[model samples]
Target: MSREAAEYALRARADERDRISGDLLDLESHTTYQVLKGASLRGSTEQRWTATQESLTTLWQLNDAYRAVLRRAEQIRASRARPGAEQLAALTELLAGSSVILRAAAKPVERRSLIPQTDLRLTLDEAVTRMNAAFREVTSALNDIDAVWNRVLPRLDGADADLSKIHDLESELGETAGLTAEESELARLRTAAVEDPLGATVEPHLDRLTRLLASSRAELDLAITVKREFAARRENLVAALDLVRAAESEARLAHGAVVVKIALPPQAQPRSRVGALAGELDALDVSADPWVLRAKRLARLEDDARKAAEQARTTAKALYGLIGRRDELRGRLGACEAMAARKGLAEDPAVSESFARAHALLWNAPCDLTKAAAAVENYQRAIHGGK
Candidate 1:
C-alpha cells in the first residue's frame, strides 16, 4: 500500500467507526424506537414490533462488527511503531473490508473471514467498493422498516383493501350501469396503484376513487328505484283510473237518488273527459323503456286523470241541483198561473210576461236555477198584490 493510500484508508475506517457509533447512539434515541419502547406493541402491531426489533438488533450487531474491524485495523497499525512496508501493507489490506483475517482470543490464530467469501487482497479500489456496500444492508433494512411503518403497513391496514373493494364495486356498477366513466376510473385507480404504490399520488387517487365509488353507488340506487317505479307505474295508473271510475259511479248513484224527487227532464250528458284522460295515459311511452321521460309523462297522466275525475263529480252535483231547481220553478210558475186564473188575473199581460221570463230561465240547457227561482217569486208577489 502506498503511504498516502494507507493514511487515507486508515482515516476513512476510523471515521466510519466513529460515524457508526454516533448513529447507534442516535438510533437508540430515535423517536420511532422510543415510541415503540414505551408501548405494548400487541394486537395488530405485534408483527411490526417484531420486524422493527430485528432491525434494531441488526444495528447493534453492525455496531459490534464495525468496532471489531476498527480494532483489527488499529492492531495492524500499532504492531510496528514505524509501520514498515509489511505493517503498512497489512494495514491497508486489513482496512480493505469485512473479508480480512482476524485472530481469536486464546492466541493470535488465522481464521478465514465470513463476509466476502474470497481471500484475495482487497486493493484500494476494492476498499472503496466495499465501504460503499458496507452500510447497504442495515441502511436498506432501516429504510424498509420505516417504509413498512409509514407506508406499506398503513396501506395494508385499510387502503389496499378499500381500493380493491371500490374497484370491484365499481366494476359491478359498470356491468349493469353500462357507463364508460366508471371503467375508466377503475383503470386509472389500477394504474395509480401500480405506478405510485407508495407515493403521495396513490393516496389521493384512492381518496378520489372512494368518493367516486360512493357517487356510483348512489347512481346505481337511483337507477334501481327508477326501474322499480317504472315497472309498477302501469299498474299504479290503472288502479288510479279504477278509483276514478268508482268515484264516477258513486256520483251517478248520488244523482240517481236525488233525481226521483226533481221530476225534471233528463239533461244531455257530456263526453267522458275521464275516458280521454285514460286514452292519453295508455298512449304514454311504456314501450320505449325511456325511464326519465316516462316518469315525467306518467306524472302528468296521473294528474290529468285525477282532475278529470274531480271535474266529473263536480258537474254531476251541479246537474243534480239544476234539475231540482228547474222542477221547483216549473211547479211554482204553474201555481202562480192558477192563482192568477182563479183571481181573474190569468189573462193579464203582467202574468204572461212573468211566466215567459221564468220559463226562459228554467228551460235553458244549464238552467240558471237562481234567476228562475227569483222570477217565480216575482210572479207570485205580483199575483198576491205585492203582499
Candidate 2:
C-alpha cells in the first residue's frame, strides 16, 4: 500500500518471477522427465505418470498466471515515473490480492442452475505455494520412475547376455533341449520390467535363471572339451601306462639284483592296476560313446595310470637306493683299511681282526648291514688305539 512499499515489492517479485521461470524450464527439459513423457508405461508406473502429468500441467498454468500478475504490477509501476496513490493501490491489489484465477465457472449450456460453481483463485503467495506443491509431485514421480528404470534395465541386460552364453554353449555341445523354460522366464521378466517396473520382482527370478545358465554352460563346455580332446587324452593315458611298465621292469631287475647281493633287503612294492587300467582304457570307445560318460571314465583311467607309474618309479628308486648304500659301505671299509695300512696298523692283531670282520660283512652275499656298520666303526676305533 504505500508508494515505497509497492516499489520495493515490485522489484522483489521481479526477481522471484525470473527464478521460478528458470526452474520451470529446467524441470521441463530434465532427462528423466522427458523419458517419462514419451514412454509407454503400465501398472503403477502408468498411474503415477498420469497423475504427475496433471501436476506438471497445473504447475505451468500457475507459473503463467503468476507471471501475468507480476507483469501487470510491473506495467502499472512503469506507467508513471513516480506513481500516484491510485497506481500504488492497483499494484497492491495485483501483488497481494486474489488476482490469479485458477479456474472459471462454466456457464449453463441448457438451463440455469440453482447453485453457482465458484471460480478457484489465489493471491500471489498462494499461487507460489501451489506451484511448489505441484513441483514436488512432478519431481517425486520422476525420481520413482528413474529409480525403477535404473535398477531393472541393467539387470535385464545382464540376463540377456547370460542367455546368449547359454545359447552359444548349447550350440557347441549340440544340445538345445531344456532351455525353453529359461528363455520364457527371461521374456516374462523383461515384460514386467518394461511395463510394471514399479512392481516387478525381477532380481530373485533373474538370479535363479543366472545360476541355471551358468551350470548349463559349465556342463556343455566340459562335454565340448572332452569331445575335442579325447584322442590327446587317450594318448596321454597310453604314455602313462608305458611309463608304468618301464618303471616296473626297472624295479624287477633291481629286486633280482638285491635278492642275490643283500642278506635281507625289503621286498619291492608290487606292481598295481596296470592290466586293469589298460583294460579300462581299451573299453572306452570314443566313437560310439557319449563324451560326458567317456570323459568320466577317461579321467578315472588317467588318474589310476599316473598313480601306478609314480608308485613303480618310487619302488625302483628305493631298490636302487639300497644297492647304493651297500656300495657306499664297502668303499668306506676299503678307505678305513688303507688308513690302517698307512699308520702301519694293518698287521696289528686287533686292527687286522676288525678289518677282516668289517670286510666280510661288506663283501659277503646277503650282507648284514647293521653288523657291518658296527664292524667298520670298530675298525675305525682300532686304528686310533680305541681312543
Candidate 3:
C-alpha cells in the first residue's frame, strides 16, 4: 500500500481502538459503582436485596462490554488490508494489555461471592494493576501516532507544493508545438506522477484508517466512563465494609454486656458465704487474754462457726448457678463464632480470640467458681479489648 494509504489505515485503527477502550471503561465504571452500592446496602441497618441485584446486573454488563471491545480490537488488529506491519504490532500489544486488564476485572466478580473482605481487596488490586497497564499502552500508542504525524505533515506539504509546480510547468509546455517527442513523453510522465504519486490504491486505505481512528476514539471515551464508575463503586464498597465491621463489633459488645450482667448476683441477698465467714470471725469475743473467755461465750462462738460453715454450702450453690449461666453464655458465643466462621467472617483475629476465651470460661469447674468468676471478668475485658 502507498504511504498515505498506510498512514490513513493506522489512523483508522487508532480511532477504533480509542472508541472501544472508552466503552469498556464506561462499563467498568458503572460496574464498580454498582458494587459499591451493593456493599453499602449490605452494611446498612436495613437489608436491601435490590442493591445486590443492581450490582450483579452492572457486573454482567461490564463483562459483556469488555468482551465486545476485545473482539473489535482483535478484528481491527488482524484486518490485513488496512493495518500495516507496525500498526498491527501496536494493535497486538494493545490487545495483550487490554486482555490482562479484562482478566483482572473479571477475577473479582468470580470470587466476590465466596471471599472475605481481604480477598476482595486483593482481587481489586489486581484489577487496578491491569487497568493501569492497559491505559499505559493506549497512551503510548497515541503518543507514537502524534510523533508520526509531526514528521509526516511537513513532508506531505512539500510534496503537494512540488506537484503544483510540475503541473504549472506542464501547462506552460502544452502551448509549444516546437517541443520534441521525448519532451512530450516527459511532460506526460510528469502529469501522471503529479496526479497519482502514491497511486489510486491509497484512497481506500486512507478511508479505512479514518474510520478506525474514529472508532478507537469512541472506545477510549467509553473506557474512561467505565473507569470513573468503577472508582466510585470501589469507594462505596469500602465504606460499606467498614460499616459492617462496626456493626459486628457493636454486636459483640452487646453480647458481652449481657453476659456480665447475667453472671453478677443481686446485691440485696442475705449473707453469702464470704459475708457469713466475716460475721463469724467478728462475733468471736476473745478477751484481752484468750484464757479469760467464758464457757458460754466459747459455746456461742462454736455455734456461730457452724452456722457460717452451713452458709458456705449455700454460697457454693449460688456460685454454681452463676457458673452455669456463664457456661451457657460461652456456649452461645461459641455458636456465634462457628456461624461467623462458616460465613467467612472469622478472618478477624478479635473474633478468634473471643471464641477461645468463651471456650475457657465454659469448661472451668464449679468448685473454682471464684477463680472462674475472675476468669470470666478477664474474658469480658478481652472482649472489650477486641472492640
List candidate 2 stretches off by more than 4 Å. 104-116, 221-227, 237-387
Which candidate has the top score in lDDT?
Answer: 2
Candidate that beats the other on TM-score, 1 or 2, i.e. the better one: 2
Per-residue lDDT value at 18 in model 2: 85
Structural similarity to truth (TM-score) of each candidate: 0.32, 0.61, 0.18
lDDT of 3 by residue, 249-270 (tens): 4434433444443434344133
Can you write out model 1's per-residue Cα lDDT over 1-387, one digit (the tens) per residue? 776687787788678667756766776676655655665443334554566565555445445545665687678777866678887766765665444322222322365444444333333344334443543543553454455456534543354454455456545434343445655655665544433333324456556655665555555555445456765877877887887787677667766665554334556343365677678776774446444345456767878778867876786787576666678779888878888889998777887788788878767655656678898888888798867
Per lDDT, what order, best first? 2, 1, 3
Cand. 2 Cα-lDDT = 0.81
lDDT per residue (tens digit) for residues 337-374 in model 2: 89988999989999999998899888888777778888
lDDT minimum window of 10 residues, candidate 2: 263-272
**lDDT of candidate model 3 versus the reference:** 0.44
Among these predictions, the greatest TM-score belongs to: 2
TM-score of candidate 1 versus the correct structure, residues matched by position: 0.32
